[model samples]
Target: MTTAATDTKATGATGREPWGARAGRLLRAVLSWPNAAALAVAAFVAAPLYWMAATSLKPPEEIGTHPPTAWPENATWANYRDAFTDNHFGTYLLNSVLVSVIATLLVLSLSAFAGYALARLPLRGKAPIMVSLLMISLFPTIALAAPLFLLMRDMGWLNSYQGLILVYTALNVPFAIWILRNFFQSIPKEMEEVAWVDGASPLRTVLSVILPQATPGVFTAAIFTFTACWTEFLIALTLNTADRYRTMPVGLALFGSQFTVPYGTIFAAATVSVLPIALLVLIFRRAVVSGLTAGAVKG
Candidate 1:
């Protein structure tokens, strides 16, 4: 086997490794330990999700069989039919959609302004403020659940779409601000100055110049916030006690009663619940990848 170093030394006066040697080296790197570890982690995270989806398609007997099969023995769509018609998963789906959309929109709008300010404004203690905001985000959500519930109750906000949307927005804003602020800082300050030189106000500069350039960052932030709200269970569960207002995550939890849980129906509902989030990620995956790569390089 021609090792990369030996192959390079064997290169002719042209001073280039042979194409085959370079390809071999690239292939080895791709299969290196770090890459192997990454693939392992991916499989670890994906296994349960795939199991849920596969189980959803399986018949009841197959789902409970000992030494379970990785793939279904027999497939059926009865659970899916029952999910929408019998379990009221449709209402839960609609509520999740409404909350996720409104929350993402609010986060985008608020984070843009907050990020611009943190990135551009000359103010005292701004660095500390940013750090403080991030620290708040790092705190556990469960810690505030009780207080938030009480506050919402006093304001008559619980058990309603607005309450959940607002809570989701507030919970996600800090991280969004952090991401957008750093992303905004990556752009050349000269661009904003030029916009101002062209007689554009700050708001106009952002809408026309900054925002257009920040597309990837915006998409990344939106995807992050939307997924957080979409999959969040504790806050959604605590804030909305009414069956009608429960989101998809809470609905999936209630798929079976205390007496018995139907794994088939539960899996079916879970599969349905994941579709929106999966769709959102698939649609904006390129943007999320680009934004994260660029942010890492710049920051």
Candidate 2:
């Protein structure tokens, strides 16, 4: 017998794993504590979303039954129809889209320059600047609400798209800079040097060479900034209470009257509001993951 076969025989091992052993290994992996915890967390997070969808589909009468139905007994699309037709959902959606897209663009444009500077420039106090940015990002939104509202009012920007757009850009810029800076750091500096030697302007170099390689980071920042602008409630409510300027979250809260809350319609509106962000994350999940992991290692 060959040395490999002799060794295998000596160890009483087959070249292939036994079916029973393979099955047992798989079972253990499936039943691992980490897997169980992950499943539990996923279930916990998904339960409310599932309930919202189910409740939105339930008939009005079935919604208020003493014992709640896990699934809608009498499914209907009436709630969705009412949410769109009876409420200002379309307007709210448009407002959200406008604010989010504008804010995301401004944030990316500004942060791209700032991030590149922080990552590549030989500036003084870069560490302190970065730390300050991180601290600013973590600062409470509620704390800034009063000051920003007053500023907007003084500037006559309240109830205008620019008001929320500016605020969202300012609020998200710090975090975006942080993400993009880290990602930029992960890029090779030699590329920029080569571009410089080839007579490329700094702006041209960034636009053509650096930015392309940093697409993952840009997309990640865009998604985060857009999501924040989309879902933010307090700032939108405080700064823009006008019917035309209200965002989806604010609009959703205004769905029903004080005495009779329309659960199904509210759920329907909520579900609709969630779809854009969900789709965004789903579409760019890979890029987001890559961006987040880009600066985790260094040679």
Candidate 3:
């Protein structure tokens, strides 16, 4: 065996790591506090999703163990079948889709025009308008609950799809406008001027030139708006008392009877509920990243 000193000298001469240093490097990497913290946070965020999926796979008998097994012993799709067939998952899913899509579209259309005006037009008191909108967005939804309900009730709009769609659109527009305005501002003015010189109208330029370049921002806003509408609980609950008009969040809440909660069924429903949101995010992940990172270089 090589002596320690000989090994060190040999490694130094050959410009190679000694076995001990290699071990130490491995140990350091494994024990790094920052890495450990990052992994811990990642696990914390991902664990519930994993648990839900795993639980959804497990049969009724295999669930509710005090010392839970990480992997299911008997994986089955029965729970999912029950969740779909026995529950009103189809209706809830349909309601959520309509609400999320319509709300997102309305926000995008209205915010695009508003953002373009704020970014490119010579409007008076724009700063105050922006600040006011920001402040309004910051207001707690709980605070507005009573007032909104009273207003909706007065207008005979409670428990209706139109009401929920309108509320989600209005609620999300301010933030969408802010995002799109920033995106519009980040784009150079030379392009728009070029469009103008080519005999394009302002509307034509907005439609054909600037909006295409601002796709990332539009995608980001859609994700945010859609996610909010998809997962909204309190407003959906408060506004819609009828079971038929209930959204997924409310539907998820009514997963069990008083006698025995169907944990497996609940998990199954939860997994299905999360799938659409996950798919949406996955499909647009690149745009979301680009949109979020766009202004960082300039700032």
Candidate 4:
């Protein structure tokens, strides 16, 4: 009887599991679904980019061969070398960098001021102004292309960096204003008031107190504006006539015309073109997320 009772107690102890251990297992299982889904999505998105890179590295003969190769049979740097030497991609890259940086800076500066005023100042007709800006943004840019062309022609600004910058800034401002305005509104007014009480002027208050807090939103606006200008095709195509003046999009398109459709070189150029934006996102991912969330919440 004593031996049987001892065996029953041991069985009961073995059958019972601690609550903490069971809870941990359940939590891990629940989290695994989302983690697995996220990884799958990432893999799906990365596949095309990987393919582009692989094709770019492959030799010309292998590119159009039957039964596409997953990995390059003979990987070479010839495509990249040709992309620079044969296509003048170096010039195109410079133009793109200059145009994108300048345009982004101008848009951010102007938008910040406009957004700040709209959010904080008590100006008359502000509602109408905001409404008009929103309405303008909704209109298709294609509709204004003809008029813009004419205007640029009249001003002798066609094919000019200044002209491109102006158009980019104009096209981007409304959206920037809307974004920054919300971000500005999200900032507590009490902070500005405190700065004012400490003998800081309005401009100083904005520069010192507000701008720092709003860095995420500013970065978000700048990056978006830069990417848009960098990748702009229609306006760049229409305005720029000279190959030398052409931005990346125009230059890349012209690559087909210039050569026998150098797919390898084209892919190489494309990879280079996308690298900057990708790097920016990777570096400032936190700011981008915060900016997006803040803007959405405030809106």
Candidate 1 has a TM-score of: 0.86
Clashing pairs in 4: none
Per-residue alpha-carbon lDDT of candidate 1 for residues 1-299, written as tens digits (9 for 90 to 100): 56755665778457777788789999898799999899899899899999999999998888889999999877899889889998999999999999999999999999999999988998789989888988988989899899999999999999999999999999999999988888998999999989999999989999999989999999999999998999999999999999999999998888878898888988899898888878988888999998887678765
For candidate 4, the TM-score is 0.88
Model 4 global lDDT (CA atoms, 0 to 1): 0.89
lDDT per model vs. reference: 0.90, 0.92, 0.90, 0.89
Off by over 4 Å in 1: 1-40
lDDT of 4 by residue, 1-299 (tens): 99877766655666664677678878787579888788789899999989998998999999999999998999999988988898889988899899999999999889998999999998999889989989987888788888999999999999899998999989999988988998999999999999998999988988898889999999999889998999988888888888889998888888866447889999888888889998999999999999999999997
TM-score of 3: 0.86
Rank the candidate models, highest lDDT first: 2, 1, 3, 4
Cα lDDT tens digits, model 2, 2-103, are: 988866755456476667767888989878999989989989988999999899999899998988999988899999999888997889999999999999
RMSD for each of the candidates: 5.0, 4.0, 5.0, 5.7
Query: Candidate 3's residue-wise lDDT over 1-299, tens digit each?
Result: 46977876867767798889889888899679998888899899889999999999998888978799898998999998888889887898899999899999999999999999998899999999899889978988888778878988999999899999999899999988888888898999999999999999999999999999999989998898899899989888889889889999999899888897989989999999999888988999999888877735432
Q: What residue pairs clash in candidate 2, if any at all?
A: none
Best by TM-score: 2
At residue 171, give the lDDT of candidate 3: 91
Per-prediction TM-score: 0.86, 0.88, 0.86, 0.88
Comparing 1 and 4 by lDDT, which wins? 1
Candidate with the greatest lDDT versus the true structure: 2
Q: Comparing candidate 1 with candidate 2, which one achieves the higher lDDT? A: 2
Instruction: Flag regions of model 4 displaced more than 4 Å.
Output: 1-31
